[model samples]
Target chain A: MYNILEFTRNRSTSVEQTDDKTLRSYCHLNDTIMEAYVEIAVTIPDLEIISVQGDVLRPHKKEFKESFEFLKRVIGTRIGPGILKIVNGLTEGIRHKQFAFMLEECCHAVILLFTKEDLLSSPRPDDEEESIIYHRQMVLDNIRLYNRCAAFAPGSRIVEGIIPKDKDI
Target chain B: MLKFMRNKIVGIEVKDSNTVLAHGFLDDNIYSIEMNVLIDINHLEIRDIDGRWNRWTTTECKRAIPFLKEAIGLRMEGDFSQTVRKVIGRRACRHFANLLLECCYTAKQASEVLKDKFKEKHDVNNVTSENNSDKNVTPIISADMPDHSDTPFHDKPVSFSMVIDLHMHSFPASPCSSVSVDQLIKEAKRIGLDAICLTDHNYVWDRDTVEDLRQKHGFLILRGNEITTDQGDMLVFGMEKDIKGIISLAELRKEVLESRGIIIAAHPFRGFLTVGIQQIGLTLERAIKRPMFKYVDAIETLNGSVTENENRFTEKVAERLGLPKTGGSDAHEVSRVGVYATGFIDKIKDEKDLVDAIKEGRCLPTVFRKHAGLR
Candidate 1:
């Protein structure tokens, strides 16, 4: 059999506390080769963007090259709800949806990393059943974590039968 | 390691000359659901539907089974996806909706086959002639659902005199916000908000513009600023200074105190509840020890941007520290303006009244919209 198409994409994110009050997060996307990379520095607690930079090393299209210029627009903006819309509005007119996604992912990684201390300080569950119940309740408590990680994806044990409270009828 | 997998299988059978039965089975590591939908061959409308959950994760999963009845009269026609979403997806399990959509798709294909068979056997010119005449058939799902038209946007607590969304941003002031000032006011009124405060990041609304807006819309529009301090964000009311960029929390506190303004810790515990805290030793005692808590006058316990758990945590810390709780949509868009709000026991006529209310602990966090669902 002849294969008509072959594709594989991988994304990795990392955060480093550059200073006592600053966190720098980086996201890299690779589709067979290096496709896109974004780095953002935000202040702790406030999570406001102090600096941002990105490059489309292996462009999916030539229009994506213009995406780097719009990165400055995100500076001074906080990494929270509506950030994606803000990024998309700032990067409009360029085929830069992927770049916007990468920037958002970088912001999300910074937020997750900032909360790592709290996660590490939580008490451990006694058994597997208890652990499942604990995690399920955790997702229930914070529905924003839904589909954020593999463990919370739809149909996963942790999120199964969990109807989002805000689902518009 | 391979951790989880899910399988969905669907089958369609001709139950009779006028009926087609479509069966859908979904099995995974954590859930097992089987559903059967009986579809009319001529009209393509659902005649009957049934489902069962052999294995489920939560007790609430069973509550979704009864919602399946809403799909019985739905037609597998134009905009069927939206109808199914409104009917089966919203009030109950989305997995059930997904399975039902799949079964409907298969039933649609089976209906096509039956139509073809009818066309061949009866020498019919148009098997869909009857179905086409009922093109405007409205599904009963929407009418059967609870009416929210008369319901207030937020669930207000008794004894509260005025409701106000204390945290909101607008375009040109807060670059992240998509809504303009005019749009925000209109949306706030449309959603039944008694009043709204524009608390843009580092930018305070002009007093004249606010006054004009209040007069023009006949709605109370208050002014506040979301200051970015080194510690965190603070919603400062009754401050008219147009401060920009990040400042020290101490400096912000001193200024607010000097101006006789009230400061609220805005989503103070955001990102703290993203992980499972059961495995972490971060308790309320440890959380309350945060330095910023000493500076703010109140805590935003029902912020739209943060998770319910985060809001609850903030609420707990507020209770522990003897601080008043407030709510705000922190809305960048018009639609989110009143999702969460502050219910003031005393009437707030202007920014001073708002400040006085917060200073006197006359306001409590009230949720207008249950979920902001923003990311």
Candidate 2:
């Protein structure tokens, strides 16, 4: 239903080993005659969302600002299962679904960056290592579930953190 | 992505209804920074100046102005941000640096728009003339252009884009500080600070060391000291004589006032923390009403490392007294170098300009949100 007119993603790491790595995403969307650009940056190793700067590029794009600003609710969100929850809640009140999809696209790019960092790889001995691994795996699995259900009916409830009623016992 | 055919001019204007900021490229290389601010009762109009690299206010600008002139002349054949950073580095005019980069990006958008307009009108020769000339004159909005409701959120003109934290503690000087001077400098750069003052508790930075750091980093590092008074802590700048052993508030005031120095009540609202039933520093209610308050230049309205209630109380006290307000991080830790700052309308070159700005009420207290550095 929507076409991506342009898209770019950039990944950069600091010179130090313990420093944060950042991923920046920019996308241009075209639905009919309307067009807009979305820019987002996220830092990993601590999962701090920097900024989401986007604006529609046409005179007819007057009514899209509220939806675009909703994207800013993504700031300070960590890249985990909670990130998707926050993004969904922020975009729920938007009049346009295109902005929501664009936000998801940007968020997903950040999650992929976490995966590229091998967040779910083996862990060495530490006080909280196992707990940290469990949390990361949960986030990865939650993202998988989200991708699986993305094609479902828009308003259908995909209950999170719960077992389905009709599932096999 | 829009590809640049040649050196293009870009404009960035961030404005609210009453306060308007209009600045960008005046020529292909020169930048014009201007602001018309309306904060509370203050109405200040910042004027423009000429000369490419002669008259700069901050130390960073002083060091980088010549380099910028040379660098802008070089053709950009590769990544622009990296090239620019390599030339000027991060410590030089950080806030203005961000503004310049945004202007370059906006120029690309403008170029694309002009290309479309040219295609529609079937006039190729007129495109460059129309776009380039308009930019040369003023990259920002014209007098006749109507107020558009669709300005980009990030592009909105901010009231005081430049902020300098005037109260800070470094590890070597202040025993209470947890962050080293080098770490503090790094964080200040990351937070895009225009300038910073190293004001350790009861300790003055060595003049030679301060000059050495400023030279090495190319950032404005002002010399100041946080004096622990019997009444409270005071941030004093521009003191020509020694103030090391002055304990009485009245005596300190006399010396400071005589030497044309300025003092600000530092975190008076943040009463001394209690440890084993022993409390220190003057309370907010008592500090503002003290006779010493009358002698000080300004009240520190926002202290970054303090609680919200403390800052609120400080703001109320300042407002009630009709005193000019200032802000600082009071940063003992490196992570909070620029969470709060004092915003000055005019560029500050030295301690005297800083003192003058406060005395003339040309400065405003400002607080940035938690993690404002990311934005």
Candidate 3:
């Protein structure tokens, strides 16, 4: 078991050093009752998405697995200001808002990993482009806050980031 | 087969437009088909009555002839074949379909004559005229759009005075682009660009908004789309609709050919990364060759985001294939605007003019190290 974890860690390191134009990142959101994960492969210098794989694991594990194919449609997406809307569009006919939310969280985490840390809070003026990036970061930051909350209470309500303290789950 | 061989069709030798070709048996006087066609391409009209069938009188086949008049308002250029198909291809009168096609061929010849006269009088070979008729099709004298022959024409003047970036992305539409339209405009103006084209991934900016911005900023804005094809990416101009990531190279080629649109291969040598399998050699050796290379108008030899080696490889392939070359900044962020551009000898007024110039092979790729802040 320990060797398997170490091999996976070394494999990810090898992928990170593969190419200057391509970057692969993975994010996992987990709790007691349900767990969600997403892996995003994107091009650098320009964030053209190559592929995405994601899934939700809940009490209805079979149904959640069926909805996993939603993210596959976002293969050739170019991630920019409208990332959330594209994510929402991926889950359009599935009528799965929970899937959309989790997929959005995964997308934010991948973008945050790719973006330079200084650019996140560069003190730029509140223009439309700058605000859109900031909003993406805020959602990522809120997910971190929620993960910390879920650590203590595994089944705590997931708060909607824009409206403070409003439980969306 | 014997009956078809016995049927005799005699085309009368007449110099007039209302000439008729009659079909009859060798000895019988009864004529099965009498086709009278008058074609005037300059006026863009075709007059033929619909042919309908009646078992009692054996006259239903004549009703399908009027459907040929649907070709009245169509131009006899890129859409000539499509217009012919829509008129008499499948559900229409199968018997008279060949007759309608023959009429169209005659109409096309007339249009060619008019086009040559206009070209000689105005020397409007490379530039689009103010008249709306020239907006869709270039002159037949300069009928240089897509031939799949891979013939290279190096006749353009070496020195050009105008510079324009042919590809860039805008926020909200290209979800991965970090630059907004306002930011791109400001950056292009600061870099002394004569014009800039917005080519967001799979999306086009509204014409009205681009026109308003062009007037306000006093800089030219050409509309284009960076279509994501299965082979790679392409920069397409003169496509009225957005077919970004959904179209294949073959389908895109047919659509672009019919629409007379210009297509340039975007960053043809940019290699993608595969897990655990590294491309150890130069990009030129490992680059996935696009099968539709012959159909593209030109190769984007200088993309700002790609490495210098990759750009050089693209140039080498383009030279070997006898294709013209173009360049673009491929800017997703604001600061990268005008990093690379295509220089044209003649000034371009709109997207149509730009497409004509590229198809004429009167433009060259240029690199701008100063504007990209690399200097």
Highest lDDT against the true fold, candidate: 1
Write the candidate numbers in order of decreasing DockQ: 1, 2, 3
Per-residue lDDT of B239 in model 1: 82
- The residue pairs found clashing in candidate 1 are A121-B280, A121-B281, A122-B279, A122-B280, A122-B281, A123-B279, A123-B280, B154-B368
Fraction of the native A-B contacts that model 1 recovers: 0.05
Instruction: Calculate DockQ per candidate and list them.
Output: 0.07, 0.02, 0.01
Name the TM-score of chain A in model 1: 0.67
Per-residue lDDT tens digits for candidate 2, residues A1-169, read 1122121111111111133355565555543234666767755333346778777765466778888787776665444333443565556567865566566546544443333233324242232446334433432333222111111111212222433211111
**Candidates 2 and 3 compared by DockQ, better number:** 2
Ranking by lDDT: 1, 3, 2
For B1-375, candidate 3 gives per-residue lDDT tens digits of 011011212222222222222221121111134344443334444433343232211122233444444544445455454345434542243234444543444344334433554455445444342333432332111010100111222334467768899988999878667668889988888878889999988887789999999998888898999886644678999987767334556678888888889899887655321110122222433332435586699889887665454566788888777787888888877656776789898989988889999988888987653533442
Off by over 4 Å in 1: A1-140, A146-169, B1-157, B276-280, B369-375
Worst lDDT run of 10 residues, candidate 2 chain A, spans: A7-16
The TM-scores, one per candidate, come to: 0.48, 0.38, 0.42
Per residue, candidate 2 scores C-alpha lDDT tens digits across B1-375 of 210011212232322211222234321112233211111101112212112332222222333333233233222223444443433333233323433443343333333433444344445333231211111111111011001111121232346645789888998788667789888887888778888899987676788898899898988888888886544578999885555532556678888888899988887644222110011122455435655577688888777654444566677778778787888878777655676788888888778888898887777876542325232
How large a fraction of the reference contact set does each model reproduce?
A: 0.05, 0.00, 0.00
Q: Which parts of model 3 have CA positions greater than 4 angstroms off? A: A1-169, B1-157, B272-289, B369-375
